[model samples]
Target chain A: MKLREQLTALLTSLAGVWIMSYAWIVLKLGSIHVPDAGFLPFLCGAALAVLGVAWLLALHWTKRKEAPAEKRLWHRPLSSLLLMIAYGWAMETLGYISSTLVFVIAWQQIVEKEKWAKTLSIAVLSTLAMYALFVHLLKVPIPSEFFLR
Target chain B: MDIFSGLLDGFAIALTATNLLFCLLGAIIGTAIGVLPGLGPAATIALLLPITYVIGTPVTAIIMMAGIFYGAMYGGSTTSILLNLPGEAASVVTCIDGYQMAKKGRAGAALGIAAIGSFVAGTLAVVGLTMFAPPLAEFALDFGPPEYFALTTLGLLLAVTLSGGSIIKGLIILLFGLILAMVGLDPISGKIRFTFGSIGLQGGFDFVTLAMGVFGLGEILYNLESTMKTEIVTTKLGKVFPTLGDWADSRWAICRGSVIGFFVGIIPGGGAVISSLASYAIEKKYSQHPEEFGQGAIQGVAGPESANNAASSSSFIPLLTLGIPGNAAIAMIFAALMIQGITPGPFLVAEHPDVFWGVIASMYVGNVMLLVLNLPLVGLWVQMLRVPYGILAPVIVLFTTIGVYSTQNQVFDIYAMLFFAAVGYLMRKLDFDPAPLPLAFVLGPLVERSLRQSLLLSGGDPAIFVSRPISGILMVIFVLLIVGQTIFFLRRKWKRRCCVPVPPETEKSL
Candidate 1:
C-alpha cells in the first residue's frame, strides 16, 4: 500500500511533466496579452506538478509507520478487464453475435463457474435479444464483419 | 407564459400515448437499475441513449430520460432498506436506518414511506421547476460570454470542492477531463489538438461512451474486485403500506427534505447524494429523538429518500435552463438533447417549449407512476437482486460494449470505453473522485469558448471577468469560496497541531 501510494505520486508528477512538455513542444503558447490553446494546459500541468510535490511532502511529513504489502499482479477485476478487452478485439473479427456469445458463455462458465447448460442458454438468448433490440427495433447496424457477411 | 398554461401545454404533449408509454417504460427500467447494485441512472441513460435516436421527437426522448433520473431515486431506497445494499451513492445514507427498519420487520413500512415521500418530493420539485425554470432562463438571457465563463468556472470549482476528497486530486481529475475535452478539432481554430493524428480521434470521445465506460463498465469492474457474496436479508415484508403513525412521524421531515433538496439541487455539483446527506444531517440535528436515528427512525428514511428524489428532479433546472448539467446524469441528458439537434440553454424554453415543458409535465406523471410502480412491483425489484453479480457484471460489460459500438457503429468507441473504464477503476483505487471529471468534460469546451470570447470582446483584458456585474459577482463568489476553503484547511491544521500531544522524540526533533 505504501509503495502504491508513492508510485501514484511519482506517476502523477511524471504525467504533469509530460503534459507540460507536450504543450511546450507541440502546441503554441500565445503571449499573456493573447492566450492561446496551450495556455490552460500549461497552467494546469504546472499546478498538477506542484500539487503532486505537495502531496509527496505531506506524506513524508506525516511519517506514519507502515509496511509495504505483497502486490498481487492479477485479481478478479483485472481478469474481467482483460476479458472485456478480448471481447472488444474479437467482436470485429468474429462479429457481434458470435463474439458476444463466446464472451458471455466464457464469463459465466469459467469466471463464474456456472452450469454449462445455463451459461450456453443465457449467452445465446442474451445475444439474440440484443440483436433484435439493436438491429431490428433500433435499426443500429452493429458490425457484421465476419460471420453475417 | 403563465405557469399553469405552460404546464397544461406540457401535459398535452406528455399525455400522448407514445410519450406516456415511454415514460412508464423509463420508470420501470429506472427502478430496475436503481434496485440493482453496480448500476446507476447515469450509466443506464448512457446505455439507453441509442434508443433515443429511434424516438420520434426530442420531447418524448427527454421525458423518458428525465423519468429515469427521478425514478431511480424513488427505487434506490428499496435495496437500501431491504438488502442493506445501497443501489446508488444517493441511497448509501438510507442503509443506516432503513436496513435497521427491515431488521425490525418494517421493511414494507420503510419502503412504503420512501415511495410516498419520494412521490411527494418529486411532484413538488416539478412544480418548483415549472415556476422557477422559466424565470431563471429569462434571467440567464442577460448573461454574456464573460458571465458564462464565470459561471462555468464557478461550476467546476464548486464540483471540485463539494466532491468530498482531496481538493488537489479533484482539480487534477478536472484538469485531466479538460485535457481530454481538448481532443479533436479546436472549436475555435478547427485545428486538431490531441488527436495524435488518428482519424478516430477527430470526432473526439463520444459522451455516451465515456459515461457508459466510467459509470457502467468501470463500476462493474470495481465491484468484481469484491468476490465476497452479499448476504441479503430475507425479512418477510410485513405491511406494504406505512401506518398512519409512520406518516405522522415523517410528514414534516418529508417536507423539510423536499425544500432542502430543491435548493441544493439548483447548485452546480449538488446532486441526489449531497442532498440526501445534507437532509439526513439536518434531520438528525433537529430531531427531538435523535437517538432514533441509525436505529430505524422513520424520519431518517423519509427525509433522505424524499431529499434525493427532489434533488434528482430539481437538478434538471440548471441543465434545462442554463445548459449546465449539475451532475453526470444530467450531463448525459444534455448530450442526448445535443445529439437530437436541440441545444439546451436560455432559449430552450422559447425554442423548444414542447421538449422543455413536456419533460416537466412528464415528471408529474412519472412520479405518480413511480409511486404506483415501486409499491406493488417492489417484490419484482427485490427478485432482481437475486441475480448474481457474476452474471450481471458480464452482462453490463456486454451491454456497454454494444451500446458504445452502436452509437456511431465505430469499433474505436468500444476501445475508448475500455480505456476509460480502466482509468475509472484506477481513479477509484487511487482515492480520486471521478464525479468532477465528467462534469468538467461536459463544461470544458463551453469554458474555453466563453473565456476566449470574453477575452476577445475585451481586447484581452482579463478584467472583463470583473467588469461585468453578473460575472463580477460570480467571480467574487468563486474567489471567496477558494479563500474560505484555504482558511478552513489552515485552521483545521492549526487545531490539530494544538490539540495533539507531541511525543518526546518528535518534540526533541522540533
Candidate 2:
C-alpha cells in the first residue's frame, strides 16, 4: 500500500513536470497581464507538482505501515474490460448489432457463466432494443457494417 | 416577473403533455435507479445525457433530469428500510433505524413516513428555491469577472476540502482536472493547447462522453469487483401509511430536517450525504426518546429521509442562480445546460425564464409523482432489486457505449470513454474520490476564462481579486480554508510523532 501510494505520488509529480514543461516551452506562458492559453495550465501544473512532491516527502518521513491485501477478484473485471475493448473495435468494424450481440453473449457466458439459452435471448433482445432505440427512434448515426456502407 | 406569475407561467409550460410525460418517465427511472443499490443518480443521468440531443427541447430535457435528481431522494429510503442496504450514500443513515423498523414488522410505516417526509421536504425546498433563486440571480447580476473567478475558485476549493479524503490527494485530482480542461482551443486566442495534433482532440473532451466514461462505466466496473450478492429483507409491508401517532412524533423532525437540509445544500460542497447525517444528529439530540434512535424510531426514518430529499432539491439553487454546481449530480446538470447552449448564471432567470421556471415547476409535479410512485407502487420498485447484477452490468455497459457513441458518432469517443473508465476504476481502488474530478473539470473552463478576463480588466493587476468586495471576501474564505487545513494537518502530524506511545522493544532499539 505504501509503495503504491509513493509510486502514485511520483507519477503525479512526473506528470506535473511534463505538463509544466510543455506549457512553458510550447504554449508560451505569457505574463499574467496578457496571459496566454498556457497560463492557467502552467499554474495548475506547478501546484500539482508541489502537492505531489509534498506528499512524497511526507510519506517518506512517516513510518511505513502495511495494510491487508485486498482479495484479488480483479480477474473478472479485467477480463470484462478487455472484452469491452474488443467489443468497441468490433462495433466499428462489424457494426453495432452483430458486435453487441456477441459481446453480451461473451460476457454472460465467460464472465457470468450463465446458461446458453437465456444468454442468447438477452443478447439478441438487448442488441435489437438498442438498435431500434438509437438508430430508428432517436436517429443516432450508429456505425454500420463495411459491406452495408 | 412576480413569483406567482412566474410560477403560473411555469405550470403552463410544465403541464404540457410532452413535458409531463417525460417528467413521469424520469420519475419512474429515477425511482428504479434509487431502489437499486449500485447504480446512482449521477451515473444514470450521465448515461442519459445524450438523450438531450434528441429530447426536442432543453426545457423538457432539464425537467426530466431534475426529476431523476430529487426522485432518487424519495426512492432511496425504500431500500434502506426494507433491505438495510442504502440505495445511495445519502440513505446510509436510514438503514440503522429503518431496517430495525422492518424487523419490527413496521416496514410499511417506515417506508410510508420516508415517502411522506420526502414529499413535504421536497415541496418546501422547492418553495425556498422559487423565492430565493430569482433574488439571488438578480444580486449576482452585479458580479464582475473577478467575482466570478473568486466564486468558482472558492467552489473548487470547497469541493476539494469537503470531498472527504487526504486534502493533498483531492487537490492533486482537482489540478489534474483543471489540466485536462485545458486540452482544447484557447477561448481568447483560438490557439490549440494540448491536442497533440489529433483532429479528434481539437474540439476538446465532450462533457457527456467524459461523464459517461468516468461516472457511468467506471462505477459499473467498480461494482464488478464485489461478486457477493445482497439479499433483500422480505418482511411483509402491512400498510404503506403512517399512523397519526407516528406523524405526531415526526412532524417537527420533518420540518427541522427540511430547514437544515435546505441551508446546507446552499453551501458549495454541501449535499444530500452531509445534510442527511446532520439531520439525523439533530433529530436524535432533540427527540423526546433519543434512546430509540437506532431501534425502529419513526423520527429516525423521517428526519434523514426528509433532509436528503430537501437537500436534493435545494442543491439546485447554486446551479440555477450562480452557475455553480453544488455537488457531482448538479455538476452533470450544469454540463447539460452548457451542452444545450444555455449558459446558466445570473441572467438565466431573465433570459431563459421558461427553462428556469419550467424546471422549478416540474419539481412540484415530480415530487408528487415520486410520492405516488414510492407509496403504493413500492413493490414494483422492490422487484427491481431482484434483477441480478450479472444481467444489469452488461446492459449498463451497452447503454454507456451506445450513449457515448450516439453523442458525436465517433469511434474515437468510445475509446476515450474506455480510457477514462480505466482511469476511474484505478482511482476508486486507490481511495481517490472521482467526484471532484468531474466537478473541477466542469468548472475549469469557467475559472480560466473568468481569471483571464479579470486580469485583462485590471490590466494584469493581481490585486483586483482583493480590491473588489465580493471577490475579496470570497478570496479571504478561500485562503483561510487552505491555511486552516494546513494547520490542522501539521498539528495532527506533530501529535502523531510526539504523543503516540512506542513499544518497549522499539524504545530499546532506539
Candidate 3:
C-alpha cells in the first residue's frame, strides 16, 4: 500500500511538472506585474508539484505499517466500468433504447448474476422507463436513430 | 423587509402549487436515497441537476434540491436503526446505538425519536438561518476582491485540513481542481489555455458533468466493489411514537445538538458528519449513564439525528448569503443556481427575494413532510432496502448518463462523465477524498477572478491580500494552518522513525 501511494504521489508530481511546462512555455506565463491567462494555472501547477513532492518525501521518511491483507473484490466494479464505457459508445451507434436495453441486460447478467427471466424483464422495463423519462417527459434529445422513436 | 415579512413572503412562494409539488418530490427522492446506502444526497442532486432545466424557475428548482438536502438527514437514521448500516455519512454514529436499540426491540421508538429530533433541530436551524443570513450577507456586501480571494483560499485550505486524509494529497487534488477550472477560454484575455483544440473542451468541463461523473457515477462504480448483506431488523414495530421518558432523556441533548450543529455548519468545512460525531461525543459525556450509550440508549439516536439535520439546514447559510458553497451538496445547489442565471451572493436576497426566502421557508415545510414520511411511513422506506442492487445500479447509470447528456445534448459530456467516474474510483481506492475537488472546482473561477482583480487594484504588489484587515487576518490564518500541519506531520514522522524496530543489518549500515 505504501509503495502504491508513493507511486501515486510521484505520478502526481510528474503531472504537475507537465502542467507547469505547458503553462510556462505554451500558454506563456507572463510577468506577475501584468498577469496573463496562464498565471493562475502556473501557480496551481507549482503548488501541485510542491505538494506532491512533499507528500512523497513525507511517505518516504515515515515507517511503513503492514496491514492484514484481505481478499478484495475488484471484478464487479471493473466489469461494471467497462460496461458503462461500452454503453456510452453503443448509445451513439445503437441509439438510446437499443443500446440501453443491451447494456442493462449485460450488466444484470455479468455483474449481478441474475436469472435470465428476471434480468430480461428488468432490462426491458428499465430501458423503457428511462426512455419515457428522458425522451418523453423531459424531451432530452438522446439519439433515437435505431429505434424507440 | 424584516425577517417576519421576509419569512411570510417566502411562505407565500413555497406554498404555491409548483413549488410545493417539487418540494414534495425532492423530499421523497431524498428519503429514498437516504434509505439506500451508496447514493448520497450530493450524488442524487447531481444526477437530477439536468431535470432542473425543465423546471425553468430557479426558485422552484432550488426548493427541490434544498428539500433533498435536509430530508436526507431525516431519513438517514432509519437504515442505521434497522440494519446497522448508515444511509449516509452523517448517520454513521446512529448505527452505534440505533441497531442495538433495534436488537432490544425498540426500533419503533428509535425511529420515532430520530424523526422528532430531526424535525426540532431542522426547524431551529432554519430559524437561525433566517436570523443570521441577512446580517451575514449585509456584512459581506462590504467585501472587495482581496477579501473574497482570501475567503475562498481559506475555504479551500479548511476543506483540505478537515477532509480526513494526508494534507499534501488533499492540497494536490485541490490544485488539480484549480487546474481543471483553467481549461477553457480566459475570462480576461479570451485566449484559450488548455482546450487542446477540442470544441467540447472549449467551454471547459460543465459543473454537472464533472459532478455527476465524480460523485454520481463514481459512487455507483465504487459501491459495486462489494455487495452488502443487509440483516434488517425484524422486530415488530410497536408504536411509532416515543414515550415521554424518551423525550426527557433527550431534550437537553437535542438542544445541545441543535446549537452545535448550527454553528458548525456555518463554518466552511463543517457539515453533518462532524456535527453528528460531535453531538454523539457530547451526549456520551453528559449522559447520566454513559454506559447506556452503544447499549440501546435513546439519547444516542436523538442527539446525532438532530445534529445532522440541523447541520444540513445551517450549511446553506454561506451558500445563500456569501455565494460560497460549504460542501459538495451545497456546491451542486450553487451550480443549479448558476445554471439558472442566478449568481448567488450578497445581492441574491435583494434581487431574488423569492428564491432566498422561498428556499428557506420550504425547508420548514420539507422538514414537516419528512417527519410525516419518516415516522408513519418508515416501513415503506425500510422496504426500499430490499430492492436488489442489480436493478438499482443499472438504473442509476442510465439516469446519470442521460442526465449528463441532456445538459448540453452532447455525447462528449457523457464521455467526460465516464472519465471522471474512473478518476473518482481510483481516488477513493487510493484513500484520497474527492469531496474537496468539486468544492475547489466550483470556487476556482471566483478565486482566480478575485485574485486577478485584487492584483490589478494593487498594481500587482501581491501585498493587497494581506493589506486589507479582513483579508490579512484570513491570510495569516491560512499561513498558520499550513505551518501547523507541516509541524504536525514532521513530528509524527520523527516519532515513527525512532519507534519502529530497525533490522540489525540496516541499523549497522545506518
Task: Supply candidate 1's per-residue lDDT for B267.
Answer: 90
Q: Per-residue CA lDDT of candidate 3, range B338-384, in tens?
A: 99999999999999999999999999899888888888899899888
Using DockQ as the yardstick, the better of models 1 and 3 is 3
Query: Candidate 1, residues A103-129: lDDT per residue as tens digits?
Result: 998888667778988998889888888
> In candidate 2, which residue ranges exceed 4 Å CA deviation?
A58-72, A147-149, B494-510
Candidate 1 TM-score, true structure as reference: 0.95
Per-residue accuracy of model 3 over A66-121 as CA lDDT, tens digit each:
65544567898899899998988898888888898999899989998999999999
Q: Which ten-residue region of model 3 chain B has the weakest summed lDDT?
A: B501-510
Cα deviation at B508, candidate 2, in Å, is: 29
lDDT of each: 0.85, 0.88, 0.88
Q: Residue B409 of model 3: what lDDT?
A: 79
Of candidates 2 and 1, the better by TM-score: 2
TM-score of each prediction: 0.95, 0.96, 0.96
Give lDDT tens digits, candidate 2, residues B1-510: 998999999999999999999999999888888888887889889999999888889899999999988888888888899889999878999999999999999999999999999999999999999999999999999999999999999998888787666777888888988877888898888889889999998988888877888888888888888856567777789899999999999999999999999998898878898899999999999888899999999999899999999999999999999999988889889988887989999999999999999999999999998999899998888888888888899988998898888888888998889888898888888778777888888999999999999999999999999999999999999999989988877776676678985442222100
Model 3 CAPRI rating: medium
User: What TM-score does chain A reach in every model?
Assistant: 0.86, 0.87, 0.91
**Candidate 1: tens digits of C-alpha lDDT, residues B274-370:** 9999999999999999998999999999999999988998999999899988888898899889889999899999999998889999999999899
In the predicted model 1, the residue pairs found to clash are none
